[model samples]
Target: MAPCVTEWVTSCTNLILSATALHSSYRLFKDHRAPSVGLFLLGLSAALCIVHPSGSYLTSIQKEAEWAGEVLAPALVSFDFLWLSEDHNTAHILLCGSCLLLGLCDWLSADALTVMTRCLGLSSLSCCLTVCLFAGNALGALSGVALSLPLLVAPKVGAITFAPLISPAAAEGLVKWLLKGSMAVGCWASTRALSMFLLDVTDRCNMGI
Candidate 1:
Protein backbone atom coordinates (compact mmCIF):
# COMPACT_ATOMS: atom_id res chain seq x y z
CA MET A 1 0.00 0.00 0.00
CA ALA A 2 1.05 3.58 -0.56
CA PRO A 3 2.37 5.46 2.43
CA CYS A 4 -0.55 7.88 2.49
CA VAL A 5 -3.12 5.13 2.32
CA THR A 6 -1.34 3.12 4.97
CA GLU A 7 -1.24 6.15 7.21
CA TRP A 8 -4.92 6.72 6.67
CA VAL A 9 -5.83 3.14 7.43
CA THR A 10 -3.76 3.11 10.59
CA SER A 11 -5.27 6.36 11.75
CA CYS A 12 -8.78 5.10 11.14
CA THR A 13 -8.13 1.93 13.02
CA ASN A 14 -6.75 3.88 15.99
CA LEU A 15 -9.80 6.14 16.01
CA ILE A 16 -12.14 3.18 16.12
CA LEU A 17 -10.17 1.42 18.81
CA SER A 18 -9.88 4.51 20.99
CA ALA A 19 -13.55 5.37 20.61
CA THR A 20 -14.60 1.85 21.42
CA ALA A 21 -12.34 1.75 24.41
CA LEU A 22 -13.68 5.00 25.75
CA HIS A 23 -17.26 3.80 25.41
CA SER A 24 -16.49 0.45 26.94
CA SER A 25 -14.56 1.93 29.82
CA TYR A 26 -17.41 4.29 30.69
CA ARG A 27 -19.92 1.48 30.69
CA LEU A 28 -17.71 -0.78 32.75
CA PHE A 29 -16.48 1.65 35.35
CA LYS A 30 -19.28 4.09 35.83
CA ASP A 31 -20.91 4.00 39.25
CA HIS A 32 -17.96 2.04 40.68
CA ARG A 33 -17.48 4.63 43.49
CA ALA A 34 -13.86 5.51 42.94
CA PRO A 35 -14.85 8.77 41.37
CA SER A 36 -11.44 10.42 41.30
CA VAL A 37 -9.62 7.53 39.74
CA GLY A 38 -12.54 6.70 37.48
CA LEU A 39 -12.67 10.24 36.18
CA PHE A 40 -8.95 10.18 35.49
CA LEU A 41 -9.28 7.00 33.46
CA LEU A 42 -12.30 8.19 31.53
CA GLY A 43 -10.75 11.57 30.98
CA LEU A 44 -7.55 10.13 29.58
CA SER A 45 -9.42 7.76 27.31
CA ALA A 46 -11.64 10.54 26.08
CA ALA A 47 -8.67 12.83 25.46
CA LEU A 48 -6.89 10.18 23.43
CA CYS A 49 -10.00 9.50 21.37
CA ILE A 50 -10.95 13.10 20.83
CA VAL A 51 -7.51 14.53 20.13
CA HIS A 52 -6.52 11.48 18.10
CA PRO A 53 -3.87 11.81 15.41
CA SER A 54 -6.47 11.01 12.74
CA GLY A 55 -7.49 14.63 12.93
CA SER A 56 -4.24 15.64 11.33
CA TYR A 57 -5.26 13.90 8.11
CA LEU A 58 -8.40 16.01 7.88
CA THR A 59 -7.26 19.30 9.34
CA SER A 60 -5.51 22.08 7.47
CA ILE A 61 -3.46 22.81 10.57
CA GLN A 62 -2.06 19.34 10.70
CA LYS A 63 1.17 20.09 12.47
CA GLU A 64 -0.42 21.77 15.45
CA ALA A 65 -3.11 19.15 15.89
CA GLU A 66 -0.62 16.32 15.70
CA TRP A 67 0.90 17.22 19.05
CA ALA A 68 -2.31 16.42 20.92
CA GLY A 69 -2.09 12.76 20.14
CA GLU A 70 1.64 12.43 19.71
CA VAL A 71 2.60 14.07 22.97
CA LEU A 72 -0.39 15.12 25.07
CA ALA A 73 -2.21 11.81 25.11
CA PRO A 74 0.65 9.74 26.47
CA ALA A 75 1.65 12.50 28.84
CA LEU A 76 -1.83 12.47 30.28
CA VAL A 77 -1.62 8.71 30.69
CA SER A 78 1.62 9.11 32.60
CA PHE A 79 0.00 11.65 34.85
CA ASP A 80 -2.94 9.37 35.42
CA PHE A 81 -0.64 6.53 36.39
CA LEU A 82 1.03 8.68 38.98
CA TRP A 83 -2.28 9.93 40.29
CA LEU A 84 -3.56 6.39 40.70
CA SER A 85 -0.47 5.12 42.45
CA GLU A 86 -0.85 4.37 46.15
CA ASP A 87 2.62 5.67 46.96
CA HIS A 88 4.26 8.74 45.42
CA ASN A 89 7.91 7.89 45.73
CA THR A 90 10.67 10.11 44.33
CA ALA A 91 11.38 7.73 41.47
CA HIS A 92 7.77 7.70 40.38
CA ILE A 93 7.61 11.46 40.51
CA LEU A 94 10.79 11.81 38.48
CA LEU A 95 9.53 9.40 35.88
CA CYS A 96 6.20 11.11 35.53
CA GLY A 97 8.03 14.41 35.51
CA SER A 98 10.17 13.25 32.60
CA CYS A 99 7.06 12.30 30.65
CA LEU A 100 5.59 15.72 31.29
CA LEU A 101 8.86 17.39 30.31
CA LEU A 102 8.92 15.45 27.05
CA GLY A 103 5.53 16.87 26.17
CA LEU A 104 6.78 20.35 26.87
CA CYS A 105 9.87 19.84 24.75
CA ASP A 106 7.83 18.35 21.93
CA TRP A 107 6.64 21.80 20.91
CA LEU A 108 10.13 23.12 20.26
CA SER A 109 11.53 22.57 16.76
CA ALA A 110 15.20 22.70 17.70
CA ASP A 111 17.41 19.98 16.25
CA ALA A 112 19.13 19.55 19.58
CA LEU A 113 15.80 19.04 21.31
CA THR A 114 14.92 16.19 18.96
CA VAL A 115 17.38 13.84 20.61
CA MET A 116 16.35 15.02 24.02
CA THR A 117 12.69 14.44 23.22
CA ARG A 118 13.36 10.93 22.02
CA CYS A 119 15.44 9.96 25.04
CA LEU A 120 13.09 11.57 27.52
CA GLY A 121 10.04 10.12 25.81
CA LEU A 122 11.42 6.61 26.04
CA SER A 123 12.46 7.17 29.62
CA SER A 124 8.95 8.40 30.39
CA LEU A 125 7.52 5.17 29.11
CA SER A 126 9.86 3.22 31.35
CA CYS A 127 8.81 5.39 34.21
CA CYS A 128 5.15 4.62 33.66
CA LEU A 129 5.87 0.96 33.10
CA THR A 130 7.81 0.68 36.33
CA VAL A 131 5.09 2.47 38.22
CA CYS A 132 2.45 0.10 36.89
CA LEU A 133 4.53 -2.99 37.60
CA PHE A 134 5.25 -1.81 41.12
CA ALA A 135 1.52 -1.28 41.64
CA GLY A 136 0.89 -4.83 40.45
CA ASN A 137 -0.95 -3.78 37.29
CA ALA A 138 0.77 -5.73 34.56
CA LEU A 139 -1.70 -4.57 31.94
CA GLY A 140 -0.82 -0.97 32.64
CA ALA A 141 2.84 -1.77 32.16
CA LEU A 142 2.02 -3.35 28.81
CA SER A 143 0.09 -0.27 27.83
CA GLY A 144 3.05 1.97 28.55
CA VAL A 145 5.33 -0.09 26.34
CA ALA A 146 2.89 -0.44 23.45
CA LEU A 147 2.02 3.22 23.26
CA SER A 148 5.46 4.78 23.62
CA LEU A 149 7.99 2.49 21.93
CA PRO A 150 7.33 4.02 18.55
CA LEU A 151 8.55 7.41 19.69
CA LEU A 152 12.10 6.14 19.73
CA VAL A 153 11.80 3.39 17.10
CA ALA A 154 10.22 5.45 14.33
CA PRO A 155 13.23 7.67 13.78
CA LYS A 156 15.66 4.79 13.53
CA VAL A 157 13.37 2.98 11.15
CA GLY A 158 13.15 6.12 9.06
CA ALA A 159 16.92 6.43 8.97
CA ILE A 160 17.34 2.82 7.97
CA THR A 161 14.85 3.12 5.14
CA PHE A 162 16.10 6.46 3.86
CA ALA A 163 16.54 7.46 0.15
CA PRO A 164 16.67 4.72 -2.50
CA LEU A 165 16.46 2.04 0.16
CA ILE A 166 12.74 2.35 0.97
CA SER A 167 11.41 5.85 1.52
CA PRO A 168 12.21 6.84 5.06
CA ALA A 169 9.13 9.04 5.21
CA ALA A 170 6.85 6.10 4.56
CA ALA A 171 8.54 3.89 7.12
CA GLU A 172 8.49 6.65 9.72
CA GLY A 173 4.89 7.51 8.97
CA LEU A 174 3.83 3.90 9.31
CA VAL A 175 5.59 3.58 12.64
CA LYS A 176 3.93 6.75 13.93
CA TRP A 177 0.48 5.55 12.90
CA LEU A 178 1.10 2.27 14.61
CA LEU A 179 2.14 4.21 17.66
CA LYS A 180 -1.16 6.08 17.66
CA GLY A 181 -3.12 2.88 17.29
CA SER A 182 -1.15 1.34 20.11
CA MET A 183 -2.03 4.32 22.24
CA ALA A 184 -5.68 3.57 21.70
CA VAL A 185 -5.16 -0.05 22.52
CA GLY A 186 -3.10 0.77 25.57
CA CYS A 187 -5.65 3.22 26.91
CA TRP A 188 -8.52 0.78 26.56
CA ALA A 189 -6.78 -2.47 27.33
CA SER A 190 -5.03 -1.32 30.48
CA THR A 191 -8.15 0.18 32.00
CA ARG A 192 -10.38 -2.69 30.96
CA ALA A 193 -8.01 -5.37 32.14
CA LEU A 194 -7.34 -3.68 35.46
CA SER A 195 -11.02 -3.13 36.11
CA MET A 196 -11.89 -6.71 35.34
CA PHE A 197 -9.06 -7.99 37.49
CA LEU A 198 -10.15 -5.93 40.44
CA LEU A 199 -13.74 -7.02 40.03
CA ASP A 200 -12.68 -10.64 39.92
CA VAL A 201 -10.65 -10.27 43.08
CA THR A 202 -13.57 -8.61 44.83
CA ASP A 203 -15.94 -11.33 43.71
CA ARG A 204 -13.63 -14.08 44.88
CA CYS A 205 -13.23 -12.42 48.23
CA ASN A 206 -16.97 -12.19 48.72
CA MET A 207 -17.83 -15.66 47.39
CA GLY A 208 -14.76 -17.55 48.67
CA ILE A 209 -14.21 -18.76 45.15
Candidate 2:
Protein backbone atom coordinates (compact mmCIF):
# COMPACT_ATOMS: atom_id res chain seq x y z
CA MET A 1 0.00 0.00 0.00
CA ALA A 2 2.84 2.40 0.84
CA PRO A 3 4.56 1.52 -2.42
CA CYS A 4 1.37 2.10 -4.37
CA VAL A 5 0.95 5.49 -2.73
CA THR A 6 4.50 6.47 -3.64
CA GLU A 7 3.90 5.40 -7.22
CA TRP A 8 0.80 7.62 -7.38
CA VAL A 9 2.75 10.62 -6.11
CA THR A 10 5.63 10.07 -8.51
CA SER A 11 3.25 9.60 -11.42
CA CYS A 12 1.43 12.81 -10.59
CA THR A 13 4.67 14.73 -10.34
CA ASN A 14 5.90 13.38 -13.66
CA LEU A 15 2.63 14.30 -15.30
CA ILE A 16 2.99 17.88 -14.16
CA LEU A 17 6.60 18.07 -15.33
CA SER A 18 5.85 16.52 -18.70
CA ALA A 19 2.93 18.86 -19.28
CA THR A 20 5.02 21.92 -18.44
CA ALA A 21 7.84 20.86 -20.73
CA LEU A 22 5.44 20.32 -23.59
CA HIS A 23 3.81 23.68 -23.02
CA SER A 24 7.19 25.39 -22.98
CA SER A 25 8.19 23.68 -26.21
CA TYR A 26 5.01 24.73 -27.97
CA ARG A 27 5.41 28.34 -26.94
CA LEU A 28 9.07 28.44 -27.86
CA PHE A 29 8.30 27.08 -31.31
CA LYS A 30 5.83 29.90 -31.92
CA ASP A 31 8.62 32.43 -31.54
CA HIS A 32 10.49 32.62 -34.85
CA ARG A 33 13.74 33.36 -33.07
CA ALA A 34 13.23 30.85 -30.26
CA PRO A 35 12.30 27.66 -32.02
CA SER A 36 15.76 26.32 -31.25
CA VAL A 37 15.13 26.81 -27.56
CA GLY A 38 11.84 25.05 -27.86
CA LEU A 39 13.51 22.17 -29.64
CA PHE A 40 16.12 22.01 -26.88
CA LEU A 41 13.48 21.86 -24.19
CA LEU A 42 11.57 19.24 -26.13
CA GLY A 43 14.72 17.16 -26.35
CA LEU A 44 15.35 17.65 -22.65
CA SER A 45 11.85 16.50 -21.85
CA ALA A 46 12.34 13.35 -23.92
CA ALA A 47 15.68 12.74 -22.20
CA LEU A 48 13.85 12.65 -18.87
CA CYS A 49 12.16 9.48 -20.04
CA ILE A 50 15.58 7.90 -20.49
CA VAL A 51 16.48 8.72 -16.90
CA HIS A 52 13.22 7.26 -15.62
CA PRO A 53 13.54 3.79 -14.19
CA SER A 54 12.00 1.18 -16.48
CA GLY A 55 10.58 -0.96 -13.62
CA SER A 56 12.43 -4.03 -14.81
CA TYR A 57 13.51 -4.57 -11.23
CA LEU A 58 9.94 -5.41 -10.35
CA THR A 59 10.32 -8.64 -12.24
CA SER A 60 13.02 -9.74 -9.82
CA ILE A 61 10.47 -10.43 -7.14
CA GLN A 62 9.69 -14.07 -6.42
CA LYS A 63 6.15 -15.05 -7.43
CA GLU A 64 3.82 -17.41 -5.64
CA ALA A 65 3.27 -20.84 -7.23
CA GLU A 66 -0.41 -20.23 -7.85
CA TRP A 67 0.40 -16.92 -9.57
CA ALA A 68 2.94 -18.62 -11.79
CA GLY A 69 0.52 -21.47 -12.55
CA GLU A 70 -1.97 -19.27 -14.36
CA VAL A 71 -2.71 -20.07 -17.97
CA LEU A 72 -1.71 -16.60 -19.12
CA ALA A 73 1.12 -16.33 -16.66
CA PRO A 74 3.06 -13.49 -18.25
CA ALA A 75 0.11 -11.14 -18.79
CA LEU A 76 -1.81 -11.81 -15.55
CA VAL A 77 1.20 -11.97 -13.25
CA SER A 78 2.93 -8.95 -14.73
CA PHE A 79 -0.20 -6.85 -14.60
CA ASP A 80 -0.90 -7.75 -11.00
CA PHE A 81 2.67 -7.11 -9.93
CA LEU A 82 3.15 -3.81 -11.70
CA TRP A 83 2.41 -1.58 -8.73
CA LEU A 84 4.19 -3.66 -6.11
CA SER A 85 7.68 -2.22 -6.63
CA GLU A 86 9.38 0.50 -4.59
CA ASP A 87 10.72 2.38 -7.63
CA HIS A 88 7.28 3.36 -8.90
CA ASN A 89 7.94 2.02 -12.36
CA THR A 90 4.29 2.33 -13.34
CA ALA A 91 4.49 6.04 -12.64
CA HIS A 92 7.59 6.35 -14.81
CA ILE A 93 5.78 4.67 -17.69
CA LEU A 94 2.86 7.05 -17.31
CA LEU A 95 5.19 10.03 -17.24
CA CYS A 96 7.10 8.97 -20.37
CA GLY A 97 3.87 8.15 -22.21
CA SER A 98 2.30 11.50 -21.38
CA CYS A 99 5.43 13.33 -22.54
CA LEU A 100 5.32 11.43 -25.83
CA LEU A 101 1.70 12.37 -26.41
CA LEU A 102 2.28 16.02 -25.51
CA GLY A 103 5.24 16.23 -27.89
CA LEU A 104 3.02 14.90 -30.69
CA CYS A 105 0.34 17.47 -29.91
CA ASP A 106 2.93 20.23 -29.98
CA TRP A 107 4.16 19.18 -33.39
CA LEU A 108 0.69 18.80 -34.84
CA SER A 109 -0.50 22.15 -33.56
CA ALA A 110 2.45 23.99 -35.12
CA ASP A 111 2.09 22.13 -38.41
CA ALA A 112 -1.62 22.80 -38.57
CA LEU A 113 -1.13 26.50 -37.88
CA THR A 114 1.50 26.77 -40.60
CA VAL A 115 -0.72 24.98 -43.13
CA MET A 116 -3.71 27.18 -42.27
CA THR A 117 -1.71 30.38 -42.70
CA ARG A 118 -0.42 29.25 -46.09
CA CYS A 119 -3.75 27.95 -47.34
CA LEU A 120 -5.68 31.08 -46.35
CA GLY A 121 -3.06 33.49 -47.72
CA LEU A 122 -2.87 35.29 -44.40
CA SER A 123 -1.54 38.85 -44.41
CA SER A 124 1.47 39.94 -42.37
CA LEU A 125 -0.77 41.34 -39.64
CA SER A 126 -2.77 38.13 -39.49
CA CYS A 127 0.39 36.07 -39.26
CA CYS A 128 1.75 38.30 -36.55
CA LEU A 129 -1.46 38.09 -34.54
CA THR A 130 -1.55 34.31 -34.85
CA VAL A 131 2.02 34.00 -33.63
CA CYS A 132 1.40 36.43 -30.81
CA LEU A 133 -1.61 34.51 -29.58
CA PHE A 134 0.23 31.21 -29.73
CA ALA A 135 3.27 32.67 -27.99
CA GLY A 136 1.01 34.04 -25.26
CA ASN A 137 -0.45 30.59 -24.66
CA ALA A 138 3.06 29.17 -24.51
CA LEU A 139 4.08 31.82 -22.03
CA GLY A 140 1.13 30.97 -19.83
CA ALA A 141 2.03 27.30 -19.95
CA LEU A 142 5.71 27.98 -19.21
CA SER A 143 4.73 29.77 -16.03
CA GLY A 144 3.52 26.46 -14.69
CA VAL A 145 6.91 24.88 -15.38
CA ALA A 146 8.72 27.73 -13.74
CA LEU A 147 6.60 27.38 -10.63
CA SER A 148 7.25 23.63 -10.47
CA LEU A 149 10.89 23.65 -11.46
CA PRO A 150 12.17 22.57 -8.09
CA LEU A 151 9.93 19.56 -7.88
CA LEU A 152 10.82 18.60 -11.43
CA VAL A 153 14.56 18.63 -10.77
CA ALA A 154 14.62 17.18 -7.25
CA PRO A 155 14.67 13.55 -8.31
CA LYS A 156 17.72 14.01 -10.50
CA VAL A 157 20.00 15.70 -7.98
CA GLY A 158 21.51 12.51 -6.63
CA ALA A 159 22.57 11.29 -10.04
CA ILE A 160 24.05 14.66 -10.81
CA THR A 161 26.03 14.76 -7.57
CA PHE A 162 28.63 12.42 -9.03
CA ALA A 163 29.73 15.16 -11.40
CA PRO A 164 32.34 17.73 -10.29
CA LEU A 165 31.67 21.26 -9.02
CA ILE A 166 28.01 21.67 -10.04
CA SER A 167 25.01 21.65 -7.77
CA PRO A 168 22.12 20.07 -9.65
CA ALA A 169 19.44 22.11 -7.93
CA ALA A 170 21.26 25.37 -8.51
CA ALA A 171 22.00 24.49 -12.12
CA GLU A 172 18.39 23.52 -12.70
CA GLY A 173 17.21 26.72 -11.09
CA LEU A 174 19.44 28.78 -13.36
CA VAL A 175 18.23 26.92 -16.42
CA LYS A 176 14.63 27.42 -15.40
CA TRP A 177 15.17 31.13 -14.90
CA LEU A 178 16.88 31.42 -18.25
CA LEU A 179 14.09 29.55 -19.99
CA LYS A 180 11.46 31.70 -18.34
CA GLY A 181 13.31 34.85 -19.32
CA SER A 182 13.66 33.69 -22.90
CA MET A 183 9.96 32.89 -23.15
CA ALA A 184 9.06 36.22 -21.60
CA VAL A 185 11.27 38.02 -24.08
CA GLY A 186 9.74 36.11 -26.96
CA CYS A 187 6.23 36.96 -25.83
CA TRP A 188 7.11 40.63 -25.50
CA ALA A 189 8.78 40.72 -28.90
CA SER A 190 5.85 38.98 -30.58
CA THR A 191 3.42 41.46 -29.06
CA ARG A 192 5.56 44.35 -30.27
CA ALA A 193 5.83 42.86 -33.75
CA LEU A 194 2.09 42.42 -33.93
CA SER A 195 1.55 46.04 -32.95
CA MET A 196 4.01 47.20 -35.59
CA PHE A 197 2.35 45.04 -38.23
CA LEU A 198 -1.05 46.47 -37.35
CA LEU A 199 0.30 50.02 -37.50
CA ASP A 200 1.88 49.32 -40.89
CA VAL A 201 -1.38 47.98 -42.27
CA THR A 202 -3.27 50.99 -41.01
CA ASP A 203 -0.68 53.37 -42.50
CA ARG A 204 -0.85 51.65 -45.86
CA CYS A 205 -4.61 52.06 -45.98
CA ASN A 206 -4.73 55.68 -44.76
CA MET A 207 -1.79 57.32 -46.55
CA GLY A 208 -2.06 55.51 -49.90
CA ILE A 209 1.74 55.96 -50.12
Each model's TM-score? Answer: 0.60, 0.26
lDDT (CA) per prediction: 0.55, 0.34
Model 1: residues >4 Å from true position, as ranges?
A: 7-11, 17-21, 24-60, 89-107, 162-167, 193-209
Worst 10-residue lDDT window for candidate 2 reads: 65-74
Candidate 1 per-residue lDDT over residues 1-209, each given as its tens digit: 58568656755765665564456446545433222232344334434434434555544344433433444344445555554443346446644555555466647666656666566557657766777776677776776676566455645675573667558767666666666667666657656545644565567669986
On the 0 to 100 scale, the lDDT of residue 172 in model 1 is: 67
User: What's every prediction's RMSD, in angstroms?
Assistant: 6.0, 19.9
List model 2 lDDT by residue over 11-127, tens digit each.
Answer: 444344445444534543443222224323433443343234556553222111111111111111111122222224542443343334334434557555334323222222232
The C-alpha local distance difference test score for the whole of candidate 2 amounts to: 0.34
